[model samples]
Target: MRGYVAMTAQEVAEFMASGLFDVSDVYAPTSQFIVDHQDLDDEEIEYTLSMVAAEDALEMKTATSGAACVLAFEVPAESISESHDMSISLSSPLKWESLECLFEVSSDGEELTWYATQEIDANLASWLK
Candidate 1:
């Protein structure tokens, strides 16, 4: 389709400068994700998972730092009642440029609020009934 035109080299550079990425998939249930495209602190990793677990959201396994060790955590619940998009910081910086594929998932783990309006006529409905 016309929507899928390939980008030229200059176009790629421009896109990068325009903040065209959101790397949030590193904390998904179906994928083995690594945190922080850059180096980070151990506490940051813990904070990421704790946010997920506190929400009762699922992940593949434990979160770890530079080492290949498995990690576990308890979920966080404090921020939900308030509408905030959750995020985690990485323990150590990682320097990977491109990813092959990202895993995805959608669950009813948390409820979001929405509101809308509709029109009706009570008198007309009552007469029809």
Candidate 2:
């Protein structure tokens, strides 16, 4: 197979939770950080999440910076309809670099979007390293 695969929100959530991306170094510390500081408001929390997401994305991009990878985000919605909703794009040039794989975490925590190239989709595990 050699095309984009559109995964459902549940599929994305499951993939994200499957430890496929080796994000331990990227996101495992937030719990301790939050536990250490108990007075963060909504804005602070949101900002922290955004920063973490951005850093993770940058790390991925940096790894594939010069490779055959192209990472991008696809925006289905032009504007933010809710304050706590966000969408992120994670892409790479390998065999699946042509389309956008969206990672969306909605404010209600009820939705997610993820896609990938069929040929190298399973290779994300190795790539994240």
Which prediction has the highest lDDT against the true structure? Answer: 2
> All predictions: root-mean-square deviation over Cα?
21.1, 15.0
Candidate 1 lDDT over 55-76, as tens digits, reads: 4322321232111111121113
lDDT of 2 by residue, 63-112 (tens): 32311222222222321122222332223222212234444333333333
Q: Which runs of model 2 end up more than 4 angstroms from their true locations? A: 1-19, 26-31, 62-129
TM-scores for candidates 1 onward, in order: 0.19, 0.27
What's model 2's overall lDDT? 0.34
Clashing pairs in 2: 68-93, 69-93
Which residue pairs does candidate 1 place in steric collision? 38-93, 39-93, 40-91, 40-92, 40-93, 41-91, 53-75, 54-75, 54-76
Q: Model 1, residue 97: what's the lDDT?
A: 28
